[model samples]
Structure formats: C-alpha cells, structure tokens
Target: MSPPDTDLLHSLSAELSERLKDLLDQALLGMIRPNSASQFAQHAPELENFREAITHSDAKDDMDFLRNFREFVPTTNYEPYRPYIAKFFATPCKESDVKNMFAPGLPYCLAVSSMTSGKSAKTFPTYRPAPHLLHHPLYLSFPHSEGSTLSPSSLGLWQVLTVECEDGQSSKVLPVCAVTVGFQRMQMNWEVEHDKDRIDLWVPGKTDPFAISLVKSYRAFFILNALFALSDRRVATIRFLFASVFVNFLQYVEEEWPLLVDCIEKGIIPDMENVDHVRESLEKHFTANPLRAAELREIGPPGIQGWAVRVWPDLKMFIGITGGSSAASVPKVTHVLGPSVTMQAPCYGSSECFIGLPYYNGDPNTDFKVLPVDGVIEFLDVHSDEPFERVLSAWELVGGGHYEPVLTTRSGLWRYRIGDVVTVKGFAPDDGLPVINYLHRRNGGLEMAFGVTACTESQLTNAIVSASKRSIGQIIDFTIVGDERDTPITYGYLVEIGGEVGEDAKMAIEQTFEDLMANNEFRVAFWQGRARKPTIRLVKKGTFTEYRRQKCDKTNISMGQVKVPIILSDSTSKEWFLQRVIMEL
Candidate 1:
C-alpha cells in the first residue's frame, strides 16, 4: 500500500531536520575548535566584537547585518594593502618599464591607468597617467561571449578592489593594483561598447586561434607567473588563488601539466607560435626529468599536487566554490595541495547577482552567509506542494529545511528564480539568520514514468562519489543519460576513469550501484517492474575533452567558459554522449 500523504511529508520533514541538526553540530564544532578559534582570535583580535555584531539586538535588517559583517570581516575592499598598490602607481614608468617590471617569460604584463573622461568616467575615476608613461597593475582577462552567464559583477569587484580606499584617506592613487578583464573597440555598437566596458576584458571579434591558445594556456601561465613574482618579492604576497572552483583549475593543470613539465626540464619557456616546437622540447625534457615523466604517464589522481607542493609551497590559500561538482573534487584537491593550503569559499554569487553572502569556513553544511545589502532573498519551501505560496524570508527559514532561492537583485533581476535549491544548515549564533548551502539546480533531475521515480543530480553525485571511494581505480568524471524509449526505462552512466580499469574495478562500480539502488526506495520504485539494472559505460580517456570541444563548437560558447553539463537535459546533448559511449554493462 502507498504511504499516506501526511505520513510522507512528516517523514521527509523529520529526515531533513535530523540531517540539518547533524550539519549544525558539525559547523558548531568547526567554529569552536580550540586551534581554529585561537587562530582566528590571533589574526583579528576582535572575535567577541565580531560575534556580538551578528547577534546585536538592533541588527534586525539585512543592511544592518551586512554593515556589521563587513565591519568585522576583511573583504575584497580591505584597505591594508591599499598603500602598496598606491606606491606602485606613484612611481612614474613608461610602457617598456611596465613590460619589463614583470619577470622574464611571464605571458602578460600589468596594464594600469586612471579612468578616461566621458564614457569611462561613469564606471571609473578620471585620473590620468603621466604623459608618455604607462602604469603596471595586476590585470587578468577572460574570453567574453554574448549570452554567457559570466558575471559583470566580478569585473566590477576587481575595479572596486583596485580603486576604492578607506574613508578619510585622500590619496588620488587607487591603492589596489588590478585591471578588470575585457576591452572595448570603436567598431562595436554603442550598446555593445557599453556592455563590453562593464562586462568583458578582451575585445570581442572573430576568434583568434592564437588568442584561444593563449586563453587555454592561462592556468599554467598563472602558476609560472606566480612563481616568478614570488622570486622577485616585488608584488604582494600570493595569499589566495580565487576561482569558481578548484576543479576547473585542476582540469586546466591536467591538460597543461606535460607541457609545463617539459618547459621546466628544458629550462625554456614555451613559445605560443610553435606548438610543434613545444612538443619536441617537452620530449627532450622528459629524457632528463624521468621521475616527473613517470608521474605524468601514470593517471594516478586529479590535480598537480606534487608540482604545486614543490613550486608554490608558500601559496597559503585557495578560495572557490565548495558545492556541487567542485565539492566532489575537494578530496583530490586537498590530497594534491596538502594541508598547508587553506581551502576557503569566498562567497555565493552568480551572473545575476554579483555577491550574495560570506561562507562559513569549515562548515560543509552551510553553503554561504547571505549578504543583507546585496538584495532581497526569499525562499520557497521545496517540500511543500505549493512552494510559491509558502515563501519565507532569510530570517523566517528554519534549520534543516530545503527551499528554492528567489532573488530580487539591484541589477534589475526581479524575483528571479536563480534555479538553485538551498538547504538551511542552521542560524548564526547572534541574529538567528539562516546559513544555506547550494543543494543542486532546481531542474537538475531525471524523471521516470512521469515522476513515479525521480533522481536528482545531488543523488547521482552522492552515488558516484560513494562508488569512486569503493572502487580501486579512480574515476575522473561522469554523466547520466536516461533512456525512456525502452519498456522499462534504463539509465546509462558514461564514466571517465583516470587510468586503465580492469574487470575488478568495473565490477566494484557495478556492485556499488546495485547496493545504492537497493538502499534507495525511490530508485528501487523507479526500477520496479522495469529493468532491474542500469547500464555503465566506461568511456575512453580524452572523451570529456572532446565532448567539451564539441559543446563549444555547437553552442558558440568559448572553450574557456564551457562546463561539463552533469545533466543531459536535451536530446542533442544526450545523443552526443550516447555516440561517445564505449562500453555497456
């Protein structure tokens, strides 16, 4: 007999509550840990004030909470390093001087100047550089494509970091030294020009193969540049390398590791114009660096942990997303970067909203702390049948509940459903504000027989993670495809193994799946009277790379911007994966 509706809801609520309580306990433990607390105290020396600011009675509104949080925390706007940036600009330098300032073999030099008048004046200040002299500031660029989700806010943040200074400090010199990515060209329409200035760093046009190659080379270039900068001791200390997630960074490293190792062994920098030369040089380098040669040949683990430990030992922190696929890759990243590096989540944000909230360090359960100043955030109870009518404010959310984020942003996105489902881990100690973690995309799920059984991306991820841990061979990436054409619908998984997988590893993966389906009632129900077993396809190496390339070709998205879509929602994407399927279980 089917379970009663009320009973099902109660059971789900209880389960959610229990899970949340467990997460809250873990978060509390992390926060109050003797060593962690002591270290935070030592760094800030205002622990009590920070805690009190959040809990203060008058701190009832979002703006009030944001003001208190910003005052307590060291933000991107933190002024301690402002003077260092200012000092660099104060010294007069030419274009050549600016170019030569960067260490030899670095790919790009810093480009800095005060904002120009008119159009530039609106977004930036009107301070000019000395005549015939160029200033070197930290500038990084990315490929900008129309309709892409890359946030303009991130670029704006870079500008703020470089230009904004502490109150009452009257230095015309913008203290932070960094340039926002992308540039504007005259040929583009006025709207495009304004958008490019606000959003992009690189000038948009026909795709330059060389520029594409350079963009692909950025990860290696960044590491090499950091090492060179560290050697000179002129630039500020390399404290944190920030990105959306370490996984994306790891993928770039994995692709370029062999080439980079070749350069190091040959003691020569790679020439962008000559791919053949680079390959030949790498071949010669491998003869001498046999140890690295062997490591590279063995697809043991994801990431360049060994090289990072050896080269960037002083690198202290990695700030990025710790949710979704990024979280799955954390163990591998941790194993590679080692304990010296502190992995931190800077904040939660998206293309629509630039900054959301601060992430609680060491709390895997809590995704991010909401920024009261950013926008109005509402939650629709995900468990309720009519979730839209059951809207809850940030303060109104209870611990252990799941909800869909509905954001009304300052940037003109009104009541926009960000399509993210969040789980409330718990409330902050002082003001009782909810701490949430991104669970999965709202639409990230597969339905069988019109919702007779459904599996979400989160569930699939969990199962894959469990399977990987149980298997002897390391699986790098995977995607799920549902076949509804069959009488009993069958789900197929295309998995990429890090190295060659034998029968034992394959059996282990299959067995793990069997165990998971057996344990999950929803999965079991979905499969009941249909195919009892789902098929597993072990894809050959380089399959995902090819998939990404193809995706970029079809979508007009830059190769740099293409992400591995975990869910194949459409027939085209699904067929693409199906064609690449190598084996079936």
Candidate 2:
C-alpha cells in the first residue's frame, strides 16, 4: 500500500492550528474578564489605601514607610541553617551550638573567611572551626524535579522562606540567600489542598498586617476564576500584592532582627488571619499620604523587576539560573531591576546531582566551579563521533569546549547523563576545577530530515541575538518550531518584539536573518538540501506570556518554571507556537 501524501498531513496540521488558535483566543478572552466590579468590591478598601500610599509618599516618606514596614515581617533565622549545616557537614550539632556559632555575626564570618581564603564556601578545602567555618558550606537544594528523594518540607517552614537575615553587628551574611518557594511547588498537583500548602510555605505563618495581607492575596488566587480577570484593577492588585509582601518582608527583616531570632528560637508560628484589621491599619497609614494615590497610578505593569526595586532598593546581588530561557529573560529582568543589582547563577545541577557553584565575581555570565565534594563530574564531547570514548574528567576539560555532563552521584546515579550540555568557561584560578556554563539540553534541538542537518538551540539563539542587534527594537523573547509535516521541512520563528518596531524595521530584521543564513554554512546547506527558507513570524505582545501561562496550566508547572525554550523540541509546544503566529514578516 502507498503511504499518505505529505501535503495531506500539512493541510491537516494547518486546520488543527487554526482551530487551536481560535480556542486559545476565546479562552484568553474569558480569562481576562473573569470577575465583575461588584465581585472586586470587597478588596476596594485595601486597594484604595495601596493606591494612596504609592501616589502621596515622598522620597523620605517612602523610605520611612519601608523602614517601619520591614519591622513586622518574619525572616530566616538559625533554625533553617541548623539543618542545612548538619546536612552539608554531616555534623550532629545542637540548635544552641548553631546559634552560638553564628553569634559573632554570620555575614562577618563569611566575608572574612571568603576574603582570607580567596574562595567561596563551595570550594573551601576543609571546614574551619568557629567563625571561619561559616564560609565553607554552600547551601544547595533540589527544588525542581520530582525524581529526587529530598523534599523541601523535610527542613520545616523556614525551608520554604526566601528571606535572608543579616546580623546588625557585622552587616555580613550572604548578600543573597533564598529558598526556592515558587518553583518548588511546580511538581505538585494543582489541587486546592496542594495550593494551600504551597502558599503556606511561600508566605509562612505571620500575624503582622502586611504578612496577613500577603497571605490573603495568595489565598485570593485559590478562587482562580476571580483572580484571573483581565481588568487593570486586577493586574494592579496582583502587582501591589507582590510588592507589598516583598517590601513588607524586607522592611520587617531590617527593623526587627532580634525579634526574628526570638521567633525562630521560640518556634512561634504567628496566627495568619486578621485581613480586615490589616487592611484598616494600612488604610489609616496611607490616608496621611494623599499623594501616594498618584504614585500608585504611576506604578508600571505587573512584573517582578519593578516590584523588587521598590521593595529592596539596596539589593546587591540576584542569584538564579542564567542559562536557556532564563538567559533570554535576563535582559527584560535586569532592565527592570536597573544596573545596580548584580546577577549571579549559584550552581549547575538538577534533581540527579548537586553539581557546583559559580564564582562570586560580579560577572553575570561567570562559569560554575564544579563541586568535587558533591559527586564525580564527567564530560562527554557531544559533537564527537564517539561521545562515549571522549569522556573527560572534571580536570581534563578544555576552555571554550562543549560537553554533556555525566554525573556519578553518591545517591546511586552511576555515570548518568543528566542531559545538560555545558561550555567550559575556563579553569578556576585557585583550584584547577573547570569553570563551566550550561548551554542547552542534549536533546534540545531541531533535526531536519533525520539528522541530515540539525539546528541547535544555541545556534537559533545566536541567530535571534544577531537579528535583535541589527533590528530597530529589542527582541524580548522568541521560540523556533520545526514543521516536519511540510514537504520541505521549515523552521518557524516566533519573535516577540519588546517595543514598537515599524514594518520597515521588521523587514530589515527578516533581511538580516536571510543574510545570516546565507553566510552560515550549516544552515545554508540544510536549506539547500532538505529544508525550505525559514519564516519569521512577529507575534503580538503577550503571545509568549499567554504561551507560558497555557503551558503552566496544562503541565501544572509554576510560572517560575515556565520558561520559553529557544527551540521547541516537543510536538505539542511546536504546534502551539505555530498556531499563535499573529503575523508572518
């Protein structure tokens, strides 16, 4: 029997794409208009006060408010550190010992030790005694994947806290120490009970008005339909909630350092009710600052970067994954946070093995120094014909080389390929450990005509980067999809332009891509043989946002975990992107 024609498959795909697009549009419209004004009336009082505070407060008033507000929020204490220290050091120290150890001040100890040793805690030769020992442990945790046995719950409430405590005496603690609360719950089922548990972990039990308000805002999301409304008020409320929670927590930590320690030591979990009382108190405070209403109106769209700046203006460092989709989002995030906040990637690891830590230098793209204590690290040259034979030790890695990480962990993962591909950034100065940066996933690329020619995620990213530089406006986020059903397989590029880019600029971008592919040997060869000329589709604003939201909804992945991959390898993701192409340029 003869096989079905390729044209038939392509036609069917086109029909399916159109149908999906229509459904998605209707769903998005429904999501935006979820609640009526009457439904939001209960939150009006709180919202009004929030608006007043933002509009009327002067620079001095704002600073004072932040100062006073931070006094009430609960922060991380020695309790969470006790378990972390015990796990990392394999020690059986008591809670009192942990407190005393950090008594002379945690930040001072870490600073002095790191400066003297010329190495981070992750690379310290051995655990030193007393004050010096504070700089020798990099608190690592697996928050993403479910394959690992370690649960965030095992460490208790503070395990889920994102706040970092600083001792007033020395003014030294890790500039950035945070628990992964948001993404940690990405693996959980999205039921009400699970959602409640996640919220409790995120905000913790705190009776302070701000804390209670923050917790209530999170609770509001439990009524998903009500919170998902597209109204400006809803968006503003969501932003305000995050801003209030974070800013309040920051101020609370800064002001009530001793009280925080007391709570931790006494194991006192606050009663997290009194939303009405909290609202009343906040309203009273804001009523004095009438100008804050205008300021509130001026607050930009809902995003973390802006909220972060307002809450913690003294932010010195930000630690997170800077590779893959995270890398793409860096431009948008940093732009929001401004230039002061230094970005740092803490380590390169997955559910399988806690790999290593990056250097503390100011460079955002600094490579991770492999942790020898964690497990055995190996690299296989993925481009090599015999990848197995090309296995190299951690010390044997060459600078600027690409290799897949193979970890042999103490947790029974023997020579397991974690599927992450990394580039050797360089070797550490003090230690010979190769400083590597994660590049992409091993199976994360597009293969045209059964590997006749394959376009890597890195390559596609490079093209987008090159195009953005040549284009009039910045390209915020982008995704590439391989359409195999077509007779000549084509790659569709869905590019989201950040600002206004006229038709002329868009054409210029297309021309730039054409010129780039023409100059490139591999892409040129691929197009000539199997694939057709790649098409660039400029999607409407919020296309990627909707894409991410929909994906999170379908997969139960949290917004934190919903990153736009440069290359969509999965059929579902590719189809979804293809359907959302608002315009072909």
Candidate 3:
C-alpha cells in the first residue's frame, strides 16, 4: 500500500529493517573509484583553512560517498550506536574532564544551547569552537516517515547552571537556551501601561541589566508572526505565540510528544524514566504530592521552542505583551491552525553561528533531510572571518552528486557555520527530485532512524492554524512544544478563548482540532482512546499578564505573548505551577 506513506512509524520501521541490505549494496558499489583528474577540482570561494575538507568526501569509490543518501545510506547502521566518547551523568555537555566526556560512534556529549536559566545558562563546551562550523547537508530537511526511536543517552536541550554564593569555588548545570525562542527575541521595546504603571514585555532598552545585556548581546532578534496555513493554504485558525522560529532541535527524542500537553493539563505527571536517574527523579517529583501546580522548566527548548514563519501582527504595539516560552511540560499552543503542524530540531547548530536541521515529518523522532541545494554552508572562526573546518558548495552537487555541507547561505551569514557532522552516503530520489542526506552531531541531542524523521513547530502550527476557520485575531497568543521522550506528540495552549467553551463547545473544538491533527487511523486511535484532546485553559482576564507584571518587577502592562507550556520535570516545577495556576487563581 504505497509503503504506508501516511504512517510515519511503520514507514520508518519497515525502511530501517532493510537498512542493513541497503548499506551492503551501497558498499559494493562504492568499490569503484572515481577518476583522479575529476576528483580533486576546486571552486574555492575566497575562503581559507578549509580547502581540503570541501572535497574530502568526494566519491573516493564510485559510491562509498555518493551524491545521494538514499542510494548509499543503509536503512540501519551495521553496528549499534556505540559512542566511544565521555559519559556525563549529570553534566551532559560539561564535565570535570571535558576531554573524557564526549564519546564517538553515535554521541555521548550533546551540543548545548544557551537556554534561559535564572542565571547564566551556558556552561559546557568550555572550549569555544572557532566560528564557521561545517556539518552535513541533510541536517536541514524533515522528510515524511521517521519517528521510530531514540537512544537512551540522547541529550535534550543542553543546559549549564551555576549559582554564585559569594564564594571562591563553584558548582554548575549546563542548561542551554533552545535555539528557537526564549527571553532573547521576546525582549521588546514595546511596553504598555496601566495608568501610571508600565507593563513590560521587552524590558525598556534603557535600564535593567538583563534587558540591556540581551539587547547588546544579539543585535538582531527576528520575530515572525506566523499563522497556520490549512490544506488550501488558507489561514484556517489564528493565534499569536512565537518566541523562536527554530523548533528543529526540540523535535527529536519522541513521536507523539503532543500528548504530554494533555497529560500536564489533566495533571498527569506519570513517572517517566526516559533519562535514567534524571527522568526517574522527574517522575517521582511530578507524581509525588499535590499535582496541583507543577514546576516545569526546560534544560532549554523543546523547552521553549519557536515558530514556522516570521511576521508579527502588531509587533511594535502600544502596550505590554504576554511572554512566549515553551517552558512548560504541558507544552504551549503558541498558535494552532486547521491542520497546521510543524516540528524542528534546533540543535545540530553551532553557538558561533546558526546552522540547523529540520524534522523528517511534522512529528519528532523523524529522520532528518538536508536543506535544499539552493542553500550553502561554511565554517568560520568564532570571532573572525577565517574559514575554519570545511566548506560546502552543496549548490554544485544539487541533483549532480551528494557531499558534506559547507557554505555561506543567504540566511544572514558570512563564512556561515553549519552545525552538524556527517559523511555523505548518496542522494535521495525525493519524488523524482533528488536531495542529499547525512548524519548529524551525536551525543548532543536526539537519535534517529531511517525513512526521514522530522519536525517543524512552525510547520505544525501552520498546518493546524491554517486549517482553522478562525480569523487572524482570534488566537491572541499561544506556543506549541514537544512534551516527552517516548512518543512524538505535541501540546498546545491558547491564552484567549475567542469565546466561551463549555463542555460541549470544548468537545466540538477539541474534536475539530483532532480531526486536523489525527487524520489517519493511528492518530485517531490515540486521540479518541489514548491521546487526550488539547486542554483549553481560559486565563481570567489578565491573570497571565498580571503574573508577568509581577515577575517583571518593572511594569504592569498587558502584552499578549504566547509562551510555551510549563515543563514540569521535578517538584520544583510542579510547585511553581501550583502557586501560579492553582493558588493564584
């Protein structure tokens, strides 16, 4: 039956089962060597220190390193994921011994992000990679079938935590900020006021060290006002929730991560040991006592994931806007449209620059595909323009041959760095259109299978929201994020109801949304029997705005920002939720 194109799980499994055979076939073909004269050509793009790597993977044999992933890439790796790198129980990216921490083969050390910790977020990768980092090309695409499984050692968002006790010594947690959304871009100059008091969305660029630091740190914080585009490419539904546009990294690790949103909303924090002691601890805390309010935060994002598009309705508005963050375990419905769903894993990127990978499908755990040949990638010195590692003139091999990615794209970059590591296998005849695919940085984030796993928060949002018949202004604000590790589900929260929703109304709305998301039988079963519909919480007037105002400590204006859900991994998060969602109300 067309190889079960609609069923992501089955497609991935079936394809991976044959991965062994696929690889063998490719290896045999690789036995043939390419002509030497045609092998070492150069199209040096006025760069440096990366001439050799550019052609390192050139088809040594006729196919060992083919121009296509589908041809050479076995559905499965011959060997199990055996990382010979370092293993950090508590310290994922950081360790007492950085050298002994990261393993090879797969990956033991995850690439970290600078997530929003109460204090400093980044601590690991103590060593700074010189700017332009180069990785594979397939790191950008999110095909249709992936989402089978994840490795036990898979690292979520990288985080580094530290507390200054006015002492000489120190302790730390390497918490990373999700590559997509966080306090960074959300920091706006627009502030609303309540009479004499000013509500702060983006702290005034005038004072506040935090605000000043954020403003000074990243010169450009691009805010995209993305709406869901339905089947007909119509804006079916509309809401506003976009903290980041890079939901790529958060897409890995699970399939139906959306279900977590229902569980959290229903106050179901069942013990999940996805990460050994860490997940076990989270389970205990989440299921412990009063499930009332939960303290749920992210190591980073998936923690505070981002958007599918760019554009804000009234970006530079008159007042304070609500905050947007996927900081909740329940995940947030940043914005949902009729059949508008997207997933993106933001890892596979370099701190020095932003190179990334998208999901294989709208769900997490999907195999990833590289970006289009129209894109280019390049590695650079962390602080300078010197080319460091490799270079990808991938545009050259588009449909011509597959190779590692290294270039500078039009996506605001110079000696642009692509964040991923890969060895080209072969090309994929994607619907008669071929594209290159490759592996990514291991030990740092989620693992992968065959058949193209993928995710794009923006795309997902677009699918749902686009399908919605609601007007653009109906959904004031919202955010959507991956919730767990076991399944590829999603969770969302709509701050404004647009109208009242009683039992029947809620059911109708929920069912409508389910129809949009769970179109197939597998998804329908999960929602009807297992997957609970998204929880629609109607915040009392300015409850969220008030909460933000109190936290801001600077103003009391209302800015309608769609934040990611509260991620409750421990008692701390649960308790915080209790105080916020249960107690205050």
Candidate 4:
C-alpha cells in the first residue's frame, strides 16, 4: 500500500488528536470508577472463596475478616520472595515455594519484577487474566497479542508491563509507542491464527536479530511520527520508553543527520542491517521526501537543542513515570524536547500489582485513583506516631495522610509491603476513593552518617542533573551508593557521560553537587567534620547497559525484567560499579 499523502495525514492527525482529547477528558471525569469497582467486586469474593478453601473458615464480619486474613496469611516483605529468584535458575527448574505455599494447586506464570530497587529480582505469580483490547477510559486500545503461555519476548516492548497468565495467555496494559504494532510478531516469526484459542510462541536462543530490528523500527517510528505530525500541524502526546533512551536516539539523529536526510530523499533505509522486513512500511513513507527533508533542515540544527520542538512543533507532552531513579532524565528531556513539553506520570504501580489509574486535575503531580480491584490495598500510614501496627483499610484513608501501601492480590500475596510511600490527596469526587500522589520509594532516600535521610530520590536526582548540566558532560546514566570504606560514611555518585570531562570539570561537578545538597542534614554533619563530603565519579559510556546485561546473565531473567539501579544499596553491586569507575572527584 502507498503511503498516505500530506493532506490525508493531516486529516488523520486531526481525527486522532480529537479522539485522544476525548479519552483524556473522560479519565478526568472519573470514567474509570465503574471498572475498578466491578473488577474488585468480582475478585474480592473469589479471593475469599480461595482463602476459605485453604483456611477452612467462613468469616463474614469485619472483625473476622481482619483476624482471618492476618492470622491465616501473615503480612510479607520482599525478603520472603528473594529465595524464589533461584527457583527460575535451578536444574530442572520448578515453580517457587511461595507460589505453592500461598496459592496451592493454582496454576500461574511468573511475572519477573523490574529490579529497580536493587540487584535482586523478585518473581511473583500472576493469576489475573490478561487485559483485553477493549475500549475503556482507563486504557488505550492498541494492536497487541491476545494471550500466551510464554512471557513477552525480551525483544518486545519491555517498558510496557506484560501480564502473563497460567491459562496460555499474556496481555499488555500500558500504551507505549503504537507504531510497532507487528514488530514483535515479525521479530519472533510467530503466526497468529485468529481461530485458535491460544497463540503459539517461541523462545529464541539468540536475540540480536530482534534487538536490531526493534532499533530500526523505533528510529523509523519516531521520524515518521514527527514528520507526519509536523505536516499535520498537531501536537502529538506520545509515551516514551525512557528519557535516557530518547536522549540517546536524539544524539544519534544529530550525529547522522546527513545520512538520514540522504536515505529519506532517496527512499532507502539507512544501514539496512537485515531489518528490511521491519522498516519496509516506514521506508514506503520515507520515499523521495526531499521536501520533508528540506522542511526538517529549515526548522533547526540537527541536535538536542530545540530539536524536538523543531521537528515536532505540535508535540504536546511526553507521558512517563519520572519518579524514582528515572527523575534525573527529566531535565535532559526538558533540554531536548524544550521546556514547553509537560512530563506526566499518568499511572503508577509495579509488576506485583497495578494499584492506581490516572486521575487528571490541574495539579502538577498527576493524581492516581486507587483501584484495588486485582489487588486489595491496605495503607500503612507513615505519619502516625504508632505507624508499624496501624495498617488502615483503603476506604478509611483520609486526605493529607501519608502511606506505605500494602497489597493482597489474587496472586496470593497477602498484605505485601510494596516499598513505596505516597501522599494522599483528596478522594475521587465520584467514587470517594482516596486519590494519591507518589512521593518516593522508602529505600531510595540518601542516608547520612548519623542515620538521617538528608536527601530524597527527587532531591538527589536534581542535584546530579544540575551538577552534570553545569560541569559534567551530558549524562547517559547515573547511580549513587553509600560509601562506607572509612569511618566517616559518605555516598558515591557514579555518572556515565556522553563525552570526556577534564579534571577541572570533575571538581566543579562535585562542588556543584555539594552546594545543591547542602540544604539537608548532611550539610550540618559536613560542617561539623563528622561526615565526609560526597564523591562524584565518571564511569564508562555503556556502564549502565553492561550492568543490566550482567544482571540478566546472573539471574537468568530477560533484559525486559531489569532496570538501571539508581541507588546501589547492595554491597556486591556497589563494589562492581566502584571497580569500573574511570575517574573520581
């Protein structure tokens, strides 16, 4: 099929923009309430039945409910699940003990946790059915697989959460970049028979082909998405994989602008690389677009500086989870995409459970409507004087309450502390459910020598970003670890830069970081000579990529299940990164 013309593309863009606007508007109006309630109503009873079958109790009252749940199935932390990581790696690999212990005789597929917290990865059983491709306010309908026994191919969009079920099925919930509709299928060489009950999947021994194909498809997707959006004069709101990945892509485009222009003008794929099948459709659109090339050149220079705005002038915002370790990349996104592009985290949760749905308001921090459907939510109020024992129910939560959410899901996790802390905003007007905003992870805060949390994840991220922007080169990735090599404990900031930094630049980076971080308890300790000043070090360009690779290798988990650890709390990981440091300040 021939590519759509500029005029047709413009019309399509207008239609899409309107539809997107309508969907977002519905979300703000609490359209997600019914689904949350309905799902919860359905799952809550089934869970009760399961519990009754196990514990042999028909507890009906609230007192009975609390007693039965607490006594039969005790609250849990990540430590209890850590041993299960080895279950996946054992000879003649078997299911985890937690799986049998919690939900005995229940079939489940392991959803590998994104190891954002530390080096260890947690394997959680998923009993919830895959999300259907239905028109719902809380979700965006896109081309995706129906269901499968196999987990998402490591080659698939790892950034998007994939829910794998025991009943030979898998489904992705989040709306990632929509352009790669058939890319996964093509990469895996899988045939989807619409008539069949389940899809046949394969595990590839080598993933290089899929990885190469994905890169090509994404490059084309970005360029074409921007090109058409530019022609249509519409601001496109796209979900990005990460700010760091986007930054890296922009850098590549800037470096190879001439080649890109030449390829587009000649209707050829750049660096072909056996990805012809992947880029075939994209190439058709790129065909002899000299006019488009000229327009692209006229907009701005081929670099990060105002480049995104120049290419995608109507680009509205980049939606992503910018909390936790991903915070540092926000400044880079602003620098590249220009300051006008709003960065928003519409949804919040982890692999363990999908806790919150997007609740749009005027506030800068996106409000999430607590949807305790697939999972039952219990809040541990962090602000209470007697915090440990006082775990509050979801409905009992009040505005201005600070909480650490505990989840009990169909997966058989009973009151599991998810390691996150959130601040309760007001309740949702329609449902009266507590609307919350993510604050930070409990363990992500920077600890000082005197056992005081001097800086939060956001504060620490800001300091690193600010320092890098001022003195260090463009940051590719970074991590901070507690340095306890000596008596006066300090933290180490290891950053991977795009370019080399001089000795003066290194000292300036460290000094700038110290100044930015001085507003906290660490400053007082530093002034009193009780604590050593924090150190900054530069790692190799691909240090983070290597780290992720090593993690995958060690755990026998897919690359999709790993993330660049922001706060290296584990001694082994800290020592590994420290050994790879090229320079220190």
- What lDDT score is found at residue 321 in candidate 1? 49
Q: Runs in model 1 with CA error above 4 Å?
A: 1-258, 262-307, 361-366, 386-388, 484-486, 508-527, 553-561
Which parts of model 2 are misplaced by more than 4 Å?
1-294, 298-312, 385-390, 484-487, 508-527
lDDT of 4 by residue, 127-217 (tens): 4233441123233211121211111123333223233334434432321112122223323333233212212211232111222324323
Q: Ranking under TM-score, best-scoring first?
A: 4, 1, 2, 3
Looking at candidate 1, what is the lDDT of residue 155? 17
| Candidate 1: 10-residue stretch with minimal lDDT | 116-125
For candidate 2, lDDT tens digit of each residue in 1-585? 112221111112334445533443332222211211111111233234433443455524534333222222112212323333342232332222223231221211111111111112221111112333223343332322211111112111111111132342331112111122221222222222233333323222111112121232222212111111111121211111111122222233333334333333333322233244333333332212223323333443334445434533344444456556544454555555556655556566653345777654324344576764434566778778863345555545567778988754332223446667888766544434566777776776666653543555666666665666666355657777775556576666777766677445565446545654643554666556755666677777656656644543443322233356566666666676677667766
The TM-score values for the models, in the order shown, are: 0.55, 0.52, 0.30, 0.65
lDDT of 3 by residue, 1-585 (tens): 011222222122334435533543343232211111111112113222223333565644444333332222211110111121123333333333332221111111133333222222222222221123222232211112221111001112233344222233643333333322221211221111121132121121111111111211010111101100100012212222222211211222122244333344353432332222222222332322122112221221132233322211111111011221322211233331101343333323333223334333322212233432223242211222444322333222223232333432222122322333343322333311112233332212211221122322333344334323332223323333223323434343333322333334334345435544543533554545533334333343333333332322221111122122332223333233333331100
Cα shift from native, residue 106, model 3 (Å):
22
Model 2 earns a TM-score of: 0.52
- lDDT per residue for candidate 1 within 222-325, as digits (tens), equals 33332122122122112222332234445555666666555544455456532342334233322244454444445332445544444433444444445564
- Give the number of the best model, judged by lDDT: 4
Off by over 4 Å in 3: 1-111, 114-211, 214-473, 479-511, 514-517, 521-534, 540-585
Q: Give all candidates' CA lDDT scores.
A: 0.43, 0.41, 0.26, 0.53
